[model samples]
Target: EEPYVAVVYSDYLHLVCSSCFHEDAPLLIRKCKEAPLEACKGCHEVYYCGSACQQNDWKIHEAECKFLSTAVAVPSDIVRMIARLLIRRKRGDHDTFRAYNGRKFDDLMDHRSDFENMGANFDKVFNDTKNYVSIDYMVDREEIVRYVGKLLVNQFAIRGPVDTCIGNGLYIGICIFDHSCQPDLTRRSIGSKMILRSQNREQTLNKNLTVSYISPLACTEERRKLLRSNPFFFHCKCRKCEDTEQDGYARSIKCESCEGGICLVKDDSAPLRCMKCGITSSITHEEANKWNADVAIVEYFGSEDCALFIRKSMHIFSPPNMRDLAKKQS
Candidate 1:
């Protein structure tokens, strides 16, 4: 008796489970020899050898089942071409199984004119802002070209079944969102299904708001640098990035004399007047000069070292319990 087999189509080939081929003719036809006649109970599109094999593969297949079910049957010619591409990559000296990064395969073939227009529009937007934007003129053009080409190729090769089942749906309008150092939105993926949600305190999204896809750990300067360098072509003037003068350091400072909050400037000449208490005390010119020198020395020691020193300094000046509370807040 031969071992039972299970076969399914994905990416560029019909995947067959090597150990699952069985001797029973009808069972073989229903399981490994071709597309499964009986779909998995939960996601009724995937075929398995039996209840046992389905149970075993459930963990891996559950997430992808919905996506797989929605894929339209590829034409025999297209499937063959894709299979050849995969085989050539396996046999060739160079790596050819590169992932596609651009438009969907179905979309690219059906909407070539739309993509060309989009590309032209993107270029026009970039060119219009040349005066205000300080773009990195020496970016590697080859990398951009390669990325775009891969995207187009992938778009043509991978046609989702949902294309036919689902109506002629418009593409998700996410291009307008400019990059931000601290984005308000977060994205979650369950298998191939993507869900976007608000991560910030706001309950409702405002008009003209754009969603972000990047992590928000980056500081303002790093975010701006990315925006300037990327194909997105827009300098982020978001509130967090633009308000450099009000960085986290200024919010952390507390007055030693009255325990009142004080906002300090980078230069450390005289602390800004406290809004809570109307008193403004001026640091003498000598003291200001010394403070600037100290800041330079602290910065030279590196940020992590400087932060540790500041924590120790705070502990020396403040109550022990207060230091614990500050650490907790941080």
Candidate 2:
């Protein structure tokens, strides 16, 4: 709990109480004053649940208040956390750099080679952050870029009481686990701190544990792609990815030749192979394009919203296509 660093809630994310980092904050804004929620005299963009929280947070908030007051465009979320860390470090808060389980900032992997390997896109993001969020305190631009790189891979996107994301933080302690398609540990947020527990209650008999960073229901390809793209820039050799494409096959259509066989394809360009009868099926450009667009919308929405989105998509796809997808999800 001592290591839990609560970030300043951004109005951009509709968060309440920059101190406690609660969500749906605007709903509580009106009554916050008489309810004794204090607004910052500097920039009313943020608020506090009480004076104690305001006082405890001000050490880190001073620079952000100054930055927010002057800037026309708000800094991105990553920059704000980095700014807080920097401010805390300047204030002699050693805990700011110390990660959970006795790990230091230097201990986390920076992915320097990975960023360099990304080439053009890396330069674009790096340059954009520097140009947009460069503060006067850090004279060297490379320092900020380094912090950004470490954070991109190491930071956790914090969730609130609502499923919506409220802020981002670097949990030095929780960063110890490696990736597994079927993780042994799961996490839930309670106020500012995240609580982690063994997926199997009996499994906790052994203290050492691991957790999966991504959703297990995801196919091997989706899991690998997610791991490789962001901070953890490596291919996953987890049991699920190593075993079979059954999950991918489950989500895919039946083979055209052998309607009983599941059709398995690595990507849009690859031909779908029949798991039972071994039929290789080719997908048209139009079919692939529409399938991707529909998948994106379906995955992004909540359960209630997903059904409505799928219902809307029914107008675009053929009945046969919808029936196949319905079977896949089931």
Candidate 3:
């Protein structure tokens, strides 16, 4: 799906193409490398791969060209995207685009109550955006704030090589898909567009397509907490979220009786039961908690290497556990 608006992060303005969102030399495709990126002469804050890219991006960049030149520093990624949306609205371009379900920008959820509660945090971002956008585009402050809320919640992170986030983009059509902890659809970012692919084409053909807004590797509690958090405020009752058995398996411990088998402890008062062999496990919940704590330490404050993290966590987390899957994927 094509993005309504896309912007490179301020830190990557020089390294990434602002128009196509391509890296200077994309990994594994050295032959596709283009001439060195050139900063826009008008603003000098945005870069393009070539004249064609610069010309293509000029339509949206033109609105903020002079203003960006005047600013002490470039606005934040979200602010730049908001400015582009406002400029598009000012140019009567908002109505030109429609979502997969024919929803327009005004039809999208703004979650006004949540943003209002944000108070100073939201105000500060809006105020910063105002400095870069023209007065004509700022005629409707309330409407702008609404767009702020809409974009914050709807924007998709544009990922590059090795799933590194290069920037943010808004694809209204793709936003129509609901969030699921175990998603039916997976998204891949190519240039400025997003492609949603089905995990199981045959099974998902007639099913409602869902995507994981947060990492699919996240545990049920972590997934629900993130889904219900700010910018994406909604309690997820997805199949994965409602499955208690799945949650138990995720927190299971290595079995003491059986080789390579895992045991599940129903509660603190109960004995751990091996899933592979029906044997009662001698392992206690305290041991499981300690293993979890060790993984957390290495994950947050210890090693930065994903391979090392995964190696350290393998024996601790059971194979079927979400944390185990998360580490392996990382």
Candidate 4:
């Protein structure tokens, strides 16, 4: 049977080596035979294979390590323990005696008493180093449980797994960029490290733009629908969604003043407002092309330029033929 896998959403707790962009040294330890004689002298948490690798990485690693160490504030030992537990849980090599579905996973975890000893050890460590370690802050219990459950189901505990090659569950911080119909981010995997690259030529983005982890290839309506149903409960009120012209293709509404050219905003109380003119007028579905001609074009183009072209052509001149527009965009 194929092993269960979990997709861990990236967060902000991981430390990456500057020299190699490696997420964790313990994961790298598998690749190297000899351990460094001395750990990172300042941040005792991160060890190295040798002084050469450490020295080579000092310039970038030092600043990032200092910032991370200060911000995270948790003890290295505790974090390592959590990581080990995750790794152990991911290594499920024995025959699938049981299905290990979500129900079974919950049942096993409900037997918290089985792992009570480990909890005791945690408490002991916390009590012993009360001054050195910060324990007052509350962690999201559900997040930890979900992650630990993933680790156990994946059997990362036993090691030798391809997914565990870089150690999963650790959150590496990446700069946030705003969502767009056309996104600039690209994911590249090098060994165990997943690198996010900016496909755009510009090195810096504007201040007003918001950053998002998800892809922006989806249509405005589809994106809105996803935002509504997603765990993150918030409607996306982006400029794209506000465009009545685009909504016309979704069979939303049409403006009477502009004939078939302008689309109307859909609201029971709000009258149909022409997108081109500020005229408040309504039209029937028969008057306008009930089907969206631009949607197919936008889907084929899959880029900001295509969206811009469609918006301009529809609003200004005649709406382009879907086939010709789609081919050009593609």
Give the candidate number with the greatest TM-score. 3
lDDT, candidate 2, 1-330, per-residue tens:
333344644653324567666543444323224354567778666777667667867877777687667666666666666666566656666444564466666566777778768761444444444554435554355665676787777776666654556677677678767768656666555545666766355664232566667655555666788988867888888766886654444345545665456555344456666668887756553464456445543333345666665576564443444654453232
Segments of candidate 2 deviating more than 4 angstroms = 1-14, 24-38, 94-100, 120-136, 202-208, 245-330
Error of 1 at 276 (Å): 12
lDDT of 1 by residue, 214-294 (tens): 333334455566555423445788775677654324222344346644434333344544444645535443442343233
Ranking by TM-score: 3, 2, 1, 4
Residue-by-residue lDDT tens digits, candidate 4, 1-330: 112221211221234332332344444443433443345667654545456657854644454345336644544433433433333333431123233222222233222332343342334333323334234322345434443433332222111122223333222122223455434444333423444445455646433444343334344556666555422234777655676455433334434456665443332335545567777655433333333433433432336867676666553323323333444454
Ranking by lDDT: 3, 2, 4, 1
Reference-based lDDT, residue 235, model 3: 94
Q: How many steric clashes does model 4 contain? A: 17
Query: lDDT of all the models against the reference?
Result: 0.35, 0.59, 0.73, 0.39
Off by over 4 Å in 3: 26-33, 118-121, 203-207, 248-257, 263-330
Task: Give all TM-scores, in the order shown.
Answer: 0.30, 0.66, 0.78, 0.29
For residue 289, model 2's alpha carbon misses the true position, in angstroms, by 17
Name the TM-score of candidate 2.
0.66
* Model 3, span 1-330: residue lDDT tens: 778888898888898888888888644231224578888998888888888888888888887787798888888877888888887887777787676667677667888898667552567677887787767777456776788888888889998654668899988878877888767776777777798766354654323678878765445666777888788888999887898576567667776677878886333446777888989866676676555444433222223555566666666667765465464344
Candidate achieving higher TM-score, 1 or 2: 2
Better of 2 and 4 by TM-score: 2
Query: Worst ten-residue run, lDDT, model 2?
Result: 25-34
Clashes per candidate (backbone, < 3 Å)? 13, 2, 0, 17
Q: Which prediction has more favorable TM-score, 1 or 3?
A: 3
